[model samples]
Target chain A: MTAPHEPIPGTTIFDGRMAMKGYPLNKMCYSFNEAAARQEFLADEDAYCAKFGLTDEQKTAIKERNALALLAAGGNIYYLAKFIGMLGLNVQDIGAQQTGMTVEEFKAKLKAAGN
Target chain B: MAKIVGGVTTSHIPAIGNAIANELFEDPYWKPFFDGYPKAREWLAEVKPDVAIVVYNDHGLNFFLDKMPTFSIGAAPEYQNKDEGWGLKPLPPYPGDPELSWHIIESLVNDEFDICSCQEMAVDHGFTVPMALLWPDQTQRPVRTIPVAVNTVQHPLPTPARCLKLGEAIGRAVASYPKDLKVVVLGTGGLSHQLDGERAGFINKDFDLMCLEKIVDEPEALAKYSIHDLVRLAGAQGAELILWLIMRGALGRKVSKVHSNYHIPISNTGAGLLVLESAA
Candidate 1:
């Protein structure tokens, strides 16, 4: 493992260390860039995770389909977007999940925060 | 010899593309955001260049985590837009300038930039949305494009200084070409707005405005901003502003800001646009 660095509060910075740690998870997510990979994963997620060699924690995060959990498990948001996109979720939906709010609530917050 | 004519910068938000596709420009919710582009489109029409160097980051449409290149230049004859799993209608294939792309690759490599040269790339909204905004009509694209893809998604991102230096190298490369070509460099993505975490809705108009001001004259100063500090000040996704420095760097030491516009909360972003011409 690499030396531990200070963590930014309210943000999971996907630094080199996280990139290394989440390689399998990110690689799996990256594969979803192709439609066949997205379908294969949806058809059998466990097998897909195994094929990419995801860790137990990463596997659990995938099963839960939680963006924050996936981030905690070392998934970068860009790569994770592919995973969420497979579920018909957008970045806003992931933001809603990360902030522990419903999608509607998050959209309301965004609308209210207009400049 | 070729000359770097100028640069354009804008936020390549996907929602902006959706608005344009659905004809929501006149809607009150999107009007302010769309209001900022007419001048840009008009300016593009007036200053038509032979080629445009588009600087943007891919959102997993091409080059995934498997082998993420810190900097990738598309040298293909043309680039096709990918669906990105969102069912958005793909734009027509963009014509690429391989000759210019090759010249840039050779120049950047000689300058020790160590860029990844891609013969084929499927562009996502990062490359497409801004083009859509600027050109609006696919049949009449203002200029052919050469895409410069930087890695802003993975952390340990290229520093502002590095991006600036790369841009300078690119400027040199473009200028060194023997052909008498007019080229415009475009830096896309970010003007503040985070996309995740509890701080998901983060937006700093002051910082975004500061960038618009500083990028015109003092882009080198922006290099001092650390990635962590950028995330704090500009938000996660907003950190992509570093890409703008690439465009600024290519414009030489002095530039004239010909046009600019800024509006807030375009789907959780402080959308900004600018056209800078080389002072020389």
Candidate 2:
């Protein structure tokens, strides 16, 4: 969890504390590995959230499609990624959203890592 | 004795899977990353390892937060790649060596590292992308696989030092096996890139470059780093560099870095590939 460790700026380590908090959100996303779960979530997003028994904050984060908010709510990127992809978004899209950049700008930053 | 031939380590990102599926080898945007593979494939062809012990982390596929094991090894007859939500086309089941797997499990446990021996496990891109890259044509397969997943999904993960020792244990296990076999160790993922938090776009080419070099010779230098140090320098997801260390520890003490490729922005990752030979 959030065991008092030196902080990495802007990074949230998905530790046990976060894992416990994000369980419902993550479990819901983990289900997306199945095509049926994906369809079911898509058909009734609210009902799906209710089924997972997600916290109000987690539900709000999902509703807003906010990557940072989701992280703050203890979402693990591995599973949150499934939820993001289910909504027709990719990692780059989430990167851009979290960094407050356009997807192209985010990609440019990534490409610049080579130089 | 099964000779520990060497190691091949590469990025197992989901994006690369899409590129391979679409045959984007020549696509200008993807060429730099995809171009890094031919040498590795060539090396794989020459060595022709009979068994590949793949070191990767399960990205919420075979594992979940419900009960996370620090280290898990696959002992199933065959391993299947499944729909990990992105709907990347699942590849055919990669054959497994339950005998080798059980042997390794027994050895590692006997080596004092508790291991979860799994009879059924679903491998995600972490396990498949590298398989596809090394064996794009399927002919390169028929080489059985044993997956050793070091937990990277959760924090307080086994340290870089621990994973390398685990790999060393694996090398010892393979070496002690009664059967004579040519074994290859695969370290997949990382060269630094993060996928979550406000630091999502983080990538450190310098650190990755340092690792690509050190891992070939003095892996202990890399092992000196803690999991926190890795996440700090490599990015959260970039912490996967531990996988490479595990692969490195499994190689011979005197190692030759036969081939290596490093490219940036391979889908929010610093894609790296290395083909090593434990020289005679």
Candidate 3:
């Protein structure tokens, strides 16, 4: 019996020949991977805030508001990273942006901002 | 010998196809656009292509951002519909031409172009919406199809010119195939539409009109457009228009516009269609 879901061997999906000639696959792939990693970080708001020096209040706000939820509702986390990139911050910097004080003041500032 | 009977371009505004299939004529948004395709509908019946090389983009369904390819070709027996976040559209799967597909594959390979050959894959609305639009008659679609997937959804997508070069490669591939059949190169997606950010509703009629002009008269000129230029001028989602160049390129430099239509009832987007046949 033939096994199911087998792709024809030795086929080229994207032509690597002209890949970087006009469009650089390397830069594209790097940005995509970074975006995916940021998505994973956002999925768990609490840990993400802590790792990025967010205060308790900010962490609670992130968890409660579910900032990641905003990213999820929109298609593909890649675009969200683009938005963050536009703000001149990576996913980690997002937590810092919310909290003016160090990691200690994150939670309080988050709660204060929520008000 | 395969001659591009002509090429068709359209915005494929989701609602337009939905309105037609479900017979929702009363829909204010779609009525005008649907009415515009009467000539296009007639044209499809007249040409009756033997095999259609559908050039479109996949929205993270078959291949994700993980390892996205700039271009991917489908050589499967049949393709099912994919549910992309929102549920799948109500339609039967598409039939493909494996014989012609293999022939095109071999020819394109011999010409030194690498093509991805998929045995089992489901095509999204990018392929099906146009299918439903061009071939509304269930009894006779007149041609089988080969799905060509381009990586347009991702950030580092191929440039407009790169897409066009691939089209030339496609043209050469189709010409060399040892089949005496009529082929229709259907390049789907956009005159313009942007589905993101505060600037979500953006439309650029001048750029879109220029695209229609180039697809028929001077496709090479379009290759000079960068992804940033397309996105900035046409809106981010509007960048998908690059895929249309592939269809134009496949038809080669000698083509005449048999039919053309454009509408912008929807905000921040423009839709247009063109039919081109190889010059006699």
Chain B TM-score list for all models: 0.98, 0.98, 0.92
Interface RMSD for candidate number 3? 16.2
Local accuracy of candidate 1 as per-residue lDDT tens digits, A1-115? 3555456578877777788899999888888877888889889989999999999999999999877778878988787777777798776787788888898888777766554
Candidate 3's TM-score? 0.71
> Which is the leading candidate under DockQ?
2
Point to the candidate with the largest TM-score.
2
Q: A1-94 in candidate 2: lDDT tens per residue?
A: 4458898899988887888889999999999999999999889889999999999999999899998988999899999888887888989999
Candidate 2 off by > 4 Å: A1-3
Summarize candidate 2's per-residue lDDT along B100-131 as a digit string, tens digits: 99999999898999999999998989989899
lDDT of 3 by residue, B84-186 (tens): 4333444666788888777777777776666677777667768878887888776555678899888875556777877887888888777776778778888
Candidate 3 docking band: incorrect
Candidate closer to the true structure by DockQ (higher is better), 2 or 3: 2
Give the Cα error of residue A48 in candidate 3, in Å. 17
Backbone clashes in model 1, listed as residue pairs: none
Provide C-alpha RMSD values for all models, in order. Answer: 2.0, 1.2, 12.6
Q: How far off is residue B154 in model 1, in Å?
A: 2.3
TM-scores for all predictions:
0.94, 0.98, 0.71
Candidate 1: chain B TM-score against the reference chain B? 0.98
